[model samples]
Target: MSTKHFLRGMATVNYFADNVVAARDWYSELFGVEAYFQMPSRDNPAYIEFRVGDDADEFGIIDRKYAPEGMQKAPGGAILLWHVDDIETAFARLKALGATEYDPITKRGETGFVTASVVDPFGNVLGIMYNPHYVELHGA
Candidate 1:
């Protein structure tokens, strides 16, 4: 691998929500902690950020109203997959929270990777995976 200093490990994952307040509340409740940062606005905030996981990676919820021109609102392209200890529990919890199932857990026979995904209430594709290589490298 080239030693370029660009593109570090998934520093942030962003999802847009039409109802920023409701998204913030739902995510916070699911994450079991309040967001650590938010951008203020006159009406509903433009952006809210949550820092989660042992690595304290950033997960953000943005107002769909602020989406840049040409940003697709459909449930396709660029799903953010988070590394989880238990794929089954993670997938189930998201569904229990009313997230629609997109893809059930699937394992690559040789690669040792397993993944599952869901379409959230706001239409974001959230994926969870058990990546043995990630754990082996990061000791998470």
Candidate 2:
């Protein structure tokens, strides 16, 4: 018998936040995902993991204290962008989940990408993007 290991794909992207619980809840509601794991450390305080849809891959939220000091401030411009099939549907779902909508769905050139901005409960800016042409271009 032989044991093999392989890289399937990106599992998650982690963001640092001041309030782990709030961030976790915000992401859960916005992405319609649930936290699969939670670990606490003296320096980091709280670490959480959320799985997207039914996929095994997960997204992570870590306390600012655990991340590098400079990352305390949320990323500027576009902090996070999620690629969905339908922007309008995703936007409505997120809005219903208590997300504050900052912009309406708008197109992006000939690619047919639509995006909107929202702030999470912990003050992190997130974007919901729908680009059907993405997979064809990036080979995802």
Candidate 3:
């Protein structure tokens, strides 16, 4: 029997922050776009979402208070990475924007996959990678 690939693709990635507005502003500055949606009200939103990247992926920020009951307070766990054209430049820019390094850039084998992670100022883990496969498939 052949194994099925149930996970189609990344639908949305959400990060928890104590201050959703600040997170929204920071990400808006980084992506050069504003959040297209917010919950409740703009001035007191609990969640905000932005459509980013070539694929127009949804990136969301939610107030930590709304996080699952057992969510950890520190930045750690499954790091969902986003593709980047240059890992070094992206890592540097993240650092310059006040994100602390969680993992240094690493070349995975020889398949042209380089990855790095950082903790955003809001305590969310943000990962970036230079993936040849993604570039080949997406052309970006």
Candidate 4:
């Protein structure tokens, strides 16, 4: 007999916030996604896991209450970058969903990559970048 194992992919990106409910709703609207799993707690009534897309089984969200203490208090200077195919479309969508723009789109070096940042309802900084070369190289 032979035994085989494999690693699938990133299951989710965990972010922390002071207000989980507000953060959850903000992210849902920003990504145009929905919540497939939500775990409530008295200490943090908004602990939730949001689906990244229509495929509910893949990606999700972990509210601050559910995250460890270190993650929960991560500084604002620590930005989380999310890779996307279209920076303009994603930025516009996030803006439409009430995300506050932290910075306009800018290219880093000559890599043909554009990036921008925004703040969620609870002040966690999120970044979106479009980089075809990166996609080809990293397979995101």
lDDT of 2 by residue, 1-140 (tens): 64655875566877778888877777776766668788864234489887774345578888877777565464455446777777788877777777677767888788677788776656566677876766566555
Model 4 per-residue lDDT tens digits across residues 18-111: 6766776676666577656676653454556765532343434455556665653534665656778889988888788777899889998886
lDDT at position 132, candidate 3: 91
Model 1 agreement with the true structure over 1-140: per-residue lDDT tens digits: 98877876787888999998888888987899988777895246779999987789999988898787898888888777788999999988999998999988999687879999999999999888899987997796
lDDT value, candidate 3, whole model? 0.93
Please list the Cα RMSD from the true structure of every candidate, rounded to 1 decimal place. 2.2, 5.7, 1.9, 4.9
In model 1, what is the error at residue 106, expressed in angstroms? Answer: 0.8
13-59: candidate 3 lDDT, tens digit per residue: 99999999999989998999989999988899999999999989999
Error of 4 at 137 (Å): 5.9
Backbone collisions counted per model? 0, 0, 0, 0
The runs of at least 3 residues in candidate 4 whose Cα sits more than 4 Å from the true structure, single-residue gaps closed, are: 1-11, 41-44, 53-75, 137-140
Please list the residue runs of candidate 3 whose C-alpha ends up more than 4 Å from where it truly belongs after superposition. Answer: 1-5
TM-score of each: 0.89, 0.69, 0.94, 0.65
Q: In candidate 1, how many clashes are counted?
A: 0
Predicted structure with the largest lDDT when compared to the true one = 3
For candidate 2, the C-alpha RMSD (Å) to the true structure equals 5.7
Clashing pairs in 3: none
lDDT of 2: 0.71
Cα deviation at 25, candidate 2, in Å, is: 2.9
